[model samples]
Target: MRFRHPDGSIVHLAYCTNVHPAEDLDGVIAQLNGCSSLVRKELDVPVLGVGLWLANTLADRLANSSDALNRLKQALARNNLEVVTLNGFPYAGFHDRVVGKKVYLPDWTESARLDYTLDLVKVLADLLPDDASYGSISTLPLAWRVPWSRTRDAAARDAFNRLENRLAQVEATTGRRIRVAIEPEPGCVLEMIPQAAHWLTPYSGRSLIGLCLDTCHLAVQFEQPVDAFAVLARAGVEVVKSQVSAALQIADPSDPAARELLAEFAEPKFLHQTREYGGPGVDDLDLVGELSGHASWRVHFHVPVHAAPRPPLTSTTDVLDESLRHLVGGAHPLTHHLESETYTWSVLPSAPKNQQELAEGIAGELAWLRGRLVGLGLEEIK
Candidate 1:
């Protein structure tokens, strides 16, 4: 079940368990076990663990009392699955400052938000199986309201302090270090490599906190994948886990007159057009509402499979190849878990006749990753 490479490093493939609906946790685990068996039989490797996105919510709902943590432990044990990590803190009560309006007030007061985040981290640390390692607990810096000119603004300082405090508490209680991976998301507070480095420098030499380099996020920011890997390396920030996807930077394809309207859209006149007709061809009112709240919405679009295809779209296959070349080749062996985050599968123009296509997509990506590692002179675990 171990995939060892010639370089004395082992890479174990794991995946996010959110592919299935929350109600189907049991069925999801069954499918995972089946997948693991197939990988072992066919590929001769075992899936390391299952990543859970709803750790906080599930912990809250399933385990509501002091014994809630114990209940979660028992449930995970019963299912023979371990929590690889929790993905985002979107619901940690932080406000959407980037897209804020009178209608969208701050989701939580500063103190309340910090408390909720700490509580969630604590629950995660307490509930994770003894053998499970903490994956990426994201700190969404952009969600905080602060002036860009002042990096050490009170709001940013307080947020970092809260994060450090929570990380320390988790380590103390769990006796296992939790990797708090700071994801550099485009349009977020710490969007680019330099910003991520600057943010992490404050916590110099801290092992518990590191970077979660999502290729899609970096691509949208126009950062080369290799360059990003080097930045994280120089900053001494470990690349804990990565979410791979492609980003498109172009005029809104939904706009019919996109060519001619590009200039107008860049002007204040486009704001009027956006307000009136919802920016032409945008039929979804809810999406229009999201766009109206955030101007950046029109800049980069997440093209679902069903959506119109565009150029420069990086496939799961390409992402895996480039990521492995940079990561494994640079002497940064695959220590952290890897998840095939092609969630757009559901949103594809049409669902495949069966789950085979979806499974093949993941399997192919993993196989491509293995080949890259092997080509880089890394020994494959037999």
Candidate 2:
């Protein structure tokens, strides 16, 4: 999936591989054979783009062994899958029993976080196509909201400076441009659009560090899709990639029926950060307790973009549509990458029961996004 914007710049559409968690390099290879290959076949296309999610352990091994790295590349080529972007947010144990705050443990403040991300850059450079000029990786924000200390802030600043230098060296040596985009979740330090913009203020002149705009996250924060884009644009923040996904929206959280509907989506595998609007805004890490509020409520759950859940619960698919419209509706496109990141399929109450249905569901989201892009004057380049 490559599409040509009206201005002729290529826009790559991909589905994030984080949906299928692979803990090691071997598991990653198996996914290419079992999952990615099937998805590409379902689309009936010669090539499919995938936002590869390589865990910390897998990245460390690949960084050390060229033999293993070459094997991974061969597998991707054999499967007709290409990697243009990566979901580097998860450090490790993404598929564990409870991935609560561990996802943000070694946030941007630790040296290990920086090392893991640099290794991913090296691996991505090796996996990128010879003709591809740039690669993108989305990472966690600075840290969680609590435990915000000056020491932590300084550590994060130092880590970012080191990362900036490393990205420069990678480009200088390999001739491939790689960028690390910081993604804002619902409860992280840089949780909203304006906060992300503020974090990037000092690095205004830098292009390698930017924002990874997730439509689901933005909607969860109660920010309008167009307004979010405008804030990023006004701040001179480059959207390295726009993740096209939707969050579960509950109109009135106080309603008993809506609460019951949301309870079905509350699981223990991943953190379901919830956001509710009453007078101001409220944030919750999970949906375990009662969400009593009169205003609209949005959860961090990544629902299928093409379909909604049962009654009394809807998805913010309209927000995704509006965001894409603002990005590609103009003569010049906003970003070159669009990745469909619905990684909650395994936990969704209505997830596909079989592998075939899962593949169709992933492909369906990509197809829906493709139609929208084409309607906005972009065409599938094939």
Candidate 3:
């Protein structure tokens, strides 16, 4: 779905397809026909935007094969879906049951990371609709903090410099501008908005490089939505994409009920970085045991935005609300894309029991977000 902000800028709303956990081109195509189509139908919209998560092999297939790319383009058209942005943070094995720090393996310092991203850029530029002027890809924030160093910064910078030039060439050839947004997560080289802004402040390629503001990360760091945007704007870093997600919140961590439910959430599939209010941040939920139970805790787990978890445990819905209002503030457009990115549907505490229910969950998030955006005075471009 698309909306026209009061500032007259088009904001494309999509649900990231990473929730489906497909691995190859055929799997991606099946997801479009099966899950994504169900989601579009559930919303009953003429067209719905999907922030696709293409796996490494699929990216290779599409970038190197015009035939494969055309099949993908045809599939989107048939499913009444469009792609203006992609979730490129997970190189592969995103759906693996034990995806921990390995998700950050091919960091920006590696040539493999640069090559994979370039393939995504090429594919995204071609996937963009003819009427769309830009496409965005969300990537990792450099690398994990532990293994990173000032010396490694040069390799990362050199990689991005090459990317900037290639982005320019893609835009010149396709007339669709593509920008990569570094998505900051807890324990990464860039932890949150302030760190990301500080790092990008010195970069000369401002236009082609930017940040992907994941509200889950924002809330985990206890950063207010309005103020976070201010930090990025101050450093001249553009918000190319915003993932409209909510993090799991427990106001009273000592509550036994909350802890019991939280245990259910601390699954082994993905990392759930946890933070204590105004205190230290842990890489996973188990580490939260080290923090004070008296303080509020926000987990990096993306929860359903439309509904709260069982009582006593909540979500950062307020953060998502504030961010949407700020995005449509009318002073200027902060970002062009917003994706309902609750990719942990399979492990959600209130997870759907079947494929039909899964589609409902995704459609429900988008519907809830659309209502909020409309209330914010953004006209739905139906």
| Backbone clash numbers for all candidates listed | 8, 0, 0
For candidate 3, the TM-score is: 0.97
Which tens-of-lDDT digit does each residue in 177-254 have in candidate 3?
999999989889998889999887765245888889888999999998878877876788888889989999999999
Q: Indicate the TM-score of model 1.
A: 0.66
Superposition error at 151 for model 2 (Å): 2.1
- Candidate 2's TM-score reads 0.96
Instruction: In candidate 1, list every pair of residues with a backbone clash.
Output: 4-381, 5-379, 6-378, 6-379, 142-189, 305-349, 306-348, 306-349
Residue pairs that clash (backbone atoms under 3 angstroms), model 3 = none
* Cα displacement (Å) at residue 324, model 2: 0.6
Please state the error at residue 200 of candidate 2 in Å: 0.8
| TM-score versus the correct structure, for each prediction | 0.66, 0.96, 0.97
Q: 129-213, model 1: which lDDT tens digit per residue?
A: 5655454555454443333445334565676577777788767866756666666754445767778877777675776766766
Where is model 1 more than 4 Å wrong at Cα? 5-12, 21-45, 61-80, 92-113, 126-135, 144-153, 248-320, 332-335, 352-360, 374-382
Candidate 1, RMSD to the unseen true structure: 7.9
Off by over 4 Å in 2: 278-291
Model 1 accuracy (lDDT, Cα): 0.49
Candidate lDDT (C-alpha), each: 0.49, 0.86, 0.89
- lDDT at position 226, candidate 3: 76
